[model samples]
Target: MDAASRQDADTATPEFTLRSVLVGLAIGCLLCFTNLYFGLQTGWISMMSLQSALIGYLIGKTFTHPSFTPQENVVIQTTAVATGTLPLAAGFVGIIPALSLLSQETDGVDALKLSWLQGVEWSLAVAFFGVFLAVPLRKQVIIKEKLAFPSGTATAQLISVLHQTPLPQPDGLTRRRGYEALQSDDVAHEETRVVVEEDVPQDVEGEVVKKEGWADLLYSFGASAALTVAAYFFPVLFAIPLFGTHLAREWLWSFSPSLSYVGQGVIMGFPIALSMNVGMLVGWGILSPLAKLSGWSPGPVGDMATGARGWILWVALAVMVSDSLVSLVPVAWELVRDYTGHGKREGHEDDEEEPPERLVPLKWVAWGIGASILLGTLLVWVVFGSDGIKSWATVIGFVLGCLLSVLGVRALGETDLNPVSGLGKVSQLLFAVIQPRNVVANIVAGGVAEAGAMQAGDLMQDLKTGHLLRASPRAQFYGQLVGSAVSIVVTTVAYSLYTRVYEIPGKEFPAPTSFVWLNLARLLRDGSLPPHTGQFMLAFGLVAATLAGAKAHARATGASWARWIPSGVAFAIGFLNTPSFSISRLIGGVVELLYRRHLAKTHTPPGREIRLIIIASGFVLGEGVASIVGLVFRTCGVGAASCWGCGTGICAGCG
Candidate 1:
């Protein structure tokens, strides 16, 4: 090749260095613990791509030997995102916990007991299939269609901005000179000053408030972590009696002071927080009392089979599933319209062939997908037993999972929302007809589909980032492989460790999403709805569907009142957990509203919103980390009973 041709080839194919892959793997494994902590605490999983990218850049800066290019950082980020998704993909937060809850309800008739090796094998079997599934679609979905994957595009922008200037000097000379210039009056007044003043917010007295982003982050993190640890020792801190102890225990009315829930609320914002509290009041205040008065739920408050918790679980699941399915109509309509050639396109499809070197070999994808399917089937058969899920059913589930992944990716690309849970519900409904009365089969089958959707959506986003950076798809794919392998081990171990220490469905880790899955499995297994459940479910489902439709209409019409409409999904989630969680979220939501509506009325700070996010993220990370640390203490023979709030009469229950 000529010199110009060689330059083009070099630019097209950047080498994936061993150091970058290792860095990515290491970052990814650590985030696996953090993500699982968030996922189980709430249903949300924080994306770590931006965080990973910045961390990787810092690592490269600290280590002067091996240079880390933007392309290599892309690899690191891709690996981290892939591994961060493993907790959900491996069924740790949702399906596995749901299974455990099922076992608890059934008195261990059908318990899911997997050894460490089996856990790793099960995770690997379900996780990698989605990576291979996204390989062939890169050219079509990412390059040609050019669908805007918003998260991926945002990560790319951040990377580009980070690399705009050359790296700073290693010694203090260049940095000192720059800092000195910023402090000078003449330099500050210059129109084109090196430091951007727009980012610094002014206080009430018109004086510049020096940025304390790191300080704020550390303070919030420390406070949340300390609260979590302290709550462990003084269990009374976990619950505040809203009414008397009788009402607190019997009616389940108490305020849970949890920093983690407040942190989650800050990110979720006021509307969702409001909706969740509304749902909580309806479920706990209205429904629970009515059920008990009418004797529909005759058992104690905590009884899963015949109590208020179990009864409301079905209603919440119905509402959530209905809302998700109804919300999908617009996206599905656009897809159908486009496919039929009735919808508008950016332009006619280009028939020009893409460069051969840029494409992932079709043969490789085909082989990988085939292998994943076979392995998944074999593992399902071996682990779940032939009596649980038949071989044909397992194969069918995998096939359906792969198909649903297409829809999942499309939804993610267009709307920045992956309806994995909805897709899993669809899978569950399908199995309800095909293989009814098998609780294990129902849950496992849904898990298979959910895992595929989660992994596929995550990988596609990473690939979109890679595409934007002009990074080699092949290299990123390799990084994804390494990340997936590492996550399969790390996430499984983390899940096992947490489950051993904390009760899955208990206060510390409610696993709300797991309850949804568990209730649905129970419905399918017995084919007999609980007393008053069918009626209540139908009522909640209709309400959820209506609200979803109205929200969509309001958005289409640009109605100003749209923000007032509560999210059906968020409202339903309120019924899945205790009232205390919603109360804490409400507190955070009120604070967020006050800040946005009242504070910074003159001119909002550029990085003010980011500072709030940092605070929220810190709170979540601190609580999660504290939980893991607390697990270590327990393992080292710390008394679990000391953590119980039994001595405090305010909580009503004693050990």
Candidate 2:
């Protein structure tokens, strides 16, 4: 490449134009739909982003050289990754539409019915609104203070890997000799010595620069396949035995002397499934046993298990809202600094590089916010009411949602309030104050809160990536719009299919419900806590563990602590997942370790590509396959009888 081209490649702005954003959105939507369809068919939420990223990388490599500008590279890579992953997102989207159709025939379809069009519309509007809301807050959270939004950190690391270039060096020249020459008094002598040193610089050509290879592909494929198979044959077994072993252990231990064998069996069988086992031991085993002894079978706790009352639901909503509110403080501060004159500092030109001019001014943020509220109101009107009263209530709810979201952004700092549990608590508190009559409203409210939070969090991460690559803010904003829209469609579809095939008589499909609704219900009704709180505490307890893990990740693996934290969260969550999932993750972890230790041999290539493939493919296949199997079993008239052998079986007999 010529010098001008090279300079352009190096210094060119990362321009994610309206066109690129639209393309990304289109790709993201397509992937989401495909993933949703497959997820419903098979029960796997496919890894759309993973596939997109890998494909994008390959395409970029094939068409361009490593010397390509980072901006161009990101555009090509993101496009490819988005395309590859679109199917998964599509699959998720398809789930809701599928379920909505199925709910017409199913009895007690209250929980099952979700209007796909409404969901999409609201998701788009709110997601768009979230981007505007997030922009003002970015500088505070990301730049000013650098509160560790670890996911953003990981994205930055990934970008660095994708953009990094190596320069050739001359043959060996020791630093000792160079230092001695530098110490010489004569300037001419030093200049000559420097030239000589440059002429005989150290040779680094033989030194390995790690790159992704066939092994990564094999590992990703194998791991995804294994996880899919495990989720297929034994869901419940996958659920409690592997994922929620703590609950299972507690149940078994409840029988004490009578079921000692069962408890022993579990411990001996799945040692890695510790979090759930511990949780169950504490919640069901120890707590229940003690409750019985004290004659304190709290009506509230029982009610929570059987069905959440309206008051309980409200409380959950309150908790979720309140917590989210609490978390937005830092984020809001960041926004003021970025857009307005509030936080400007003298001689800070280095920090405030001129943000490119935009068609939509800061005033447009208010317009977007208004549009979001209007759209949300329309959705509520369609879902809950056609009458004027329902219309008014829906409007009120929409306004409330927007206000809550804004307040949440202002108070909480950034949106990643643990949606299942944390936001549920906020909703619960609000319900208590409002005295809402229907439990479903509280549930819906909480879902909205979570969706908002999730969208906000995602927007922040995307912006962070854009900032690092010097991509235009508008491009990042649009890309998110595309991604969220597509992802929602996929999620909806997958959810729909899974529910249809695996509708557990009285229960909703557990996965979505578990993370989203049931856990919230648990918190609101019983004031119960999630396992993450314990894990967070445990992180503090094990300083050595943190240091060791972080160091190993950074030094040995060439990954930052930011990556480790999320991975650790995934691992902890995995421990709470089905045994099959834990087993799959364990296998994946082992493979990763081996690759790092034996194969890579201290020259590790970026694992993001491999991980993206495995995680995306595994999630998609697992969910998709499981759904298909459920449909087949349902068609065959093999109800609860089929699930008897292993608790993971799909039999609805117990209910």
Candidate 3:
């Protein structure tokens, strides 16, 4: 290729097209609606990146004149996934359960529903912090430090293969060979240097390779639909749950295996599943019984009985927040001193070190951050009764949330884990102490921190994908901005409709995440902090604080001890919720590990690996689709209310 051709090939691909935006929005809206619906039902969030990529690739084939580029397809997938995982939907998913539980005066259905105006305003107030907060860290974390964003790497590789984009050859190497050189011994020599024949990427006789995109997608979709039907119908039809088990058999002690849990294992891997189980065991086996023996009554905290779970949550939050803040201790001085630019290091010159180009300009991002914070400030003040104490506390929470957002992004960029609830609890704990009497005020403040951290972490993932794909960062920023805006409106209407249609926080939806925040806020706000064990919490907090320090120390020194120690937040969350979730996740991880072992031994056919992933993703998507369909039926009053869940009743928990 000529220099100009190579330069053009290396430039950002065709992007910001109207058709691309429309397709993305269409795909994103479906995913946004379904993800919220599914999350409310299953407590899992499925990202649509890979799914969107495959669909976009197939759909792009129809626009033959321009021909769809891999880069453009990325825009479609990015926008869809970004929209699907918006902060407000997540916030509502978690918080609404607690809100529902809070308003249960006499087990009345739909007794208290937060207005669409209230829900949207609360989510809008601070959700924007995530998008802008992530922009600044790309240069420092993704490029300069080169954090391992595994998901981004996978997406980039997938795009490269799908597009057949040329992999660059080292300069001056070529497939050119003369017959004369091949016939002579002197052919190996180029003046004093021996010439080595370079391996070329392609050959003139190469056969045309075709992909079975349509066949594979159709087959996968069919299988997914079939599975969804079986999963949905078998339980209600036979009075047996196929997805998972909560029933106790006379001979069995542990709970049932969950397919969704196993699917999560496939996505999240073994370590996380194992760690989560550790927390469950500690909570259910060790702590719950112990707390019960200590004269504590079983009270409701979300879906789980309030036992040692409450204490575990408080201590875990304390540990995790400390660990999150302390992890940045080394960079703290540099950030405060010369954050305008990275400080000096050996062989690093300020003049030579070029920062990665940004999609959205730093100034615009900064302005957006300030504006978001300001918007959140006004919303919090107004929502919390226009009180001076609450408004000012909100401002302080938002500023702290912004600082924590950096940490949250860093945490996710490094660990593929964001301590979102932990950050919120930090705000909750702080605000709870400061304004002990004001539970609602405390929750609003914590919600800002949680929303900021969660969204920032999510956006960081998109930024990582854009970086790897050589995409326009600016385009991605706009896509996400647009997507989030659309998600807000769509999620608002969908969630509002759901409340009217279903009795939430009932047997159908546990809303585990919201349970923690809502219960904690209510407990603190109502002066009903349970178990009557302040001294134990104090001692546990001290120990947890020590562990948090140890984690920081281990990271600094590259100690092996770090791996042995549990994730404070995960374990704490596990302890606070039911053992079922943690145990099921562990089982899922084990299943995944076994499946991987089989794959390693079998050497599956080309694209089978990708197909297998699609199957897993499709399982998630299938269930989500089923849930949405069932929800629509329930809304239309065609759903069954039978004891055995017959007729139009798709899921047993449906209202």
Candidate 4:
């Protein structure tokens, strides 16, 4: 073939096709709604990239003529995950609800109300700046520093595993010869290098091994979805009375038959699950009883003040804050050292970086960042009012957001935990001083930080996925842009719908994260906490620090028992919610242990390596989608009470 024809053949396959974008939008819209529903209920938004990529792959394979390529799957997942995170990005699960609670406390005098139009505009304004912030850092973080970004890395590995077939070469060209031909150009050379040297799972001379798990995945998905649908109607099925009906109802100690919870535990694995169960036992079984007996918290079970739930929240927040801050010490030190010329070396002189032409242009990204900052400030002034938040505070908040997002990215890259909440608290503290005694200003400023950290970390993670797949960074950026636009509408509408249907911070929809934000803002404003909560907070903070230190040391020393070390973060999560959630998670952990110790040896199913992940993902996805569907059902005047749930009284402790 001639030179032009050869080059055209090399680049024939498209990564950013119309079908990819359309399919991605559809998936993203579903995930956006699902995440909002799930996040409000559990205070956790499960990662959606792997699920999206796998589902997108399945859909393409089943429906599309040519089938979806690995690069296209990367785009689909990148868009979908970014879009799914919108609820958090839009502050629906955290700041917005927190602000609403605060307004209620102040008798509607300080409410920062927004119409649907304003909500869409506000979310749009704050979201894009973070995407812009992530662009320039892609090379430094993903390529040069080679930060793990575990979720991103895992997604990339899955994609590679899914598309392990030998690349289609020219009519008679050998595999090596085809690679050599692509190596003539700089961009193609970089792609060829990574593919041949790092990513390709098979040898040049080896036969391609096709991996198939569609039948198993589909079966599990259908089963999980059906269960989810059934549980919505019955509700009592998931609230299993494992510890007698009284303790299950009053102390929230039931074993949940929730596929979603178990699925989460499977992904989290045994160590974290054990920690969460331990936390649930200690916080609910031990501490909660003690608190009630001692009269520290003597109100009803669900009361945010003078109740077991309220008391434990402080303890959980203390653990989470201390653990997150202590964990950041090592990362912070490295970042400081890097700036001071003593950083740990990551790459060698021989390493080849992607060509400039393939990167998101720095000049345009910088302009976009600046533009987004102005837009954010303008929106804050308009929505919150100039009196509520000064123009200067908004600018400072965004700057602080950008700075903290770097830390957020570092944590996410190293440990797969974006400490957005902890980082937001930092912003809240700063704003407490900057806009003293102003609760509205405090929460809004913190919103900027949380949104920035979340969006920046999310985009960076997506970029890392693209990097591994040899997908164009520019295409991924565009995909993110489009997905973000969809998120604004989806998240706002979902939040609006839910608020109309149910009272937030109520029994059914206890938004845990919002309470954290609300309590902190209240403490800053009122200069006090409930009862003897201060003592408990101090004690738990120390324990959290100790556990965090121990975990870090265990990992550093490569201890044999390191894997058994309880994660402080998981412990905090356990403390944050009801025991039913944690108990269900432990069930999944037990299953994981069984699978590891016995099932793997006994069962050699097709796609044995990824079977667990597929099944677990199905459970999570099925429940999330079903929850959204249920929400719609409730909104359409089909009250949940009409079902065989708490209203019909099949079981005692439905809540």
Candidate-wise lDDT, in order: 0.70, 0.37, 0.56, 0.71
Measured against the true structure, the TM-scores of the candidates, in listed sequence, are 0.84, 0.58, 0.77, 0.88
Could you give candidate 3's per-residue lDDT for residues 1-655 as a string of tens digits?
8755644564545576777777778777777766776566545565556567666766676554575666676678777876777623347666656655554332222223568887777667765777787777766666565565444444554554456654232211232211000000000000000111123222210111125555555565556556544544344532233333332111011332444444544555455567667766766666555655675635432224553445455544444455444444543554554455555333222221222452567789889988998897886665445542367777787787878777666665554446565567677878878766555566667777777767776666666666666666777777777777777777777788777876665445555556666666766666544565555556656666676567666755868666455555555555544555566657656766676566557854333444444444554555555666666766777644443533333334432
**What order do you get sorting by TM-score, best first?**
4, 1, 3, 2
* Candidate of highest lDDT: 4
Model 1 pairs in collision: none
Model 2 alpha-carbon drift over 4 Å, by segment: 1-55, 62-69, 72-112, 115-127, 143-148, 165-215, 226-281, 288-351, 354-360, 386-421, 504-508, 512-655
Error of 4 at 390 (Å): 1.6
RMSD of 4: 7.1
Choose 2 or 4, whichever is better by TM-score.
4
User: Per-candidate RMSD vs. true structure?
Assistant: 8.8, 12.8, 10.3, 7.1
**lDDT (C-alpha) at residue 23 in model 4:** 89
lDDT, ranked from best to worst:
4, 1, 3, 2
**What shift in Å separates residue 465 of candidate 4 from its native position after superposition?**
1.8
Between candidates 3 and 4, the lDDT winner: 4
Query: How many backbone overlaps does candidate 2 show?
Result: 116
lDDT of 1 by residue, 140-163 (tens): 577657766656655564454344
How much is the lDDT of residue 264 in candidate 4?
70
Give the Å error, residue 632, model 4. Answer: 2.8
User: What's model 3's overall lDDT?
Assistant: 0.56
| Clashing pairs in model 3, backbone N/Cα/C closer than 3 A | 262-588, 359-473, 359-474
lDDT of 4 by residue, 1-655 (tens): 7654533442456877889988898888877876776678777775477778777877886789898888888889888877878888878887787777766554234655567877887797687888888987776677667786766765665566566633332112122111110000000000011112233344321222123456656677677778877776667776666777677656766666888788776766666678878988888888888788888889966577778888888888788778877777776888999878798564433332345555689898989989989988998888888777898998999999899888888877765667777788889989989988888888889988778877898778788877766677878888888888888988888888888877776666778888888788878887787678799889989988887778667756757675566666677777777888887778777776676566346744323445666677777777877777777777786643423434423242244
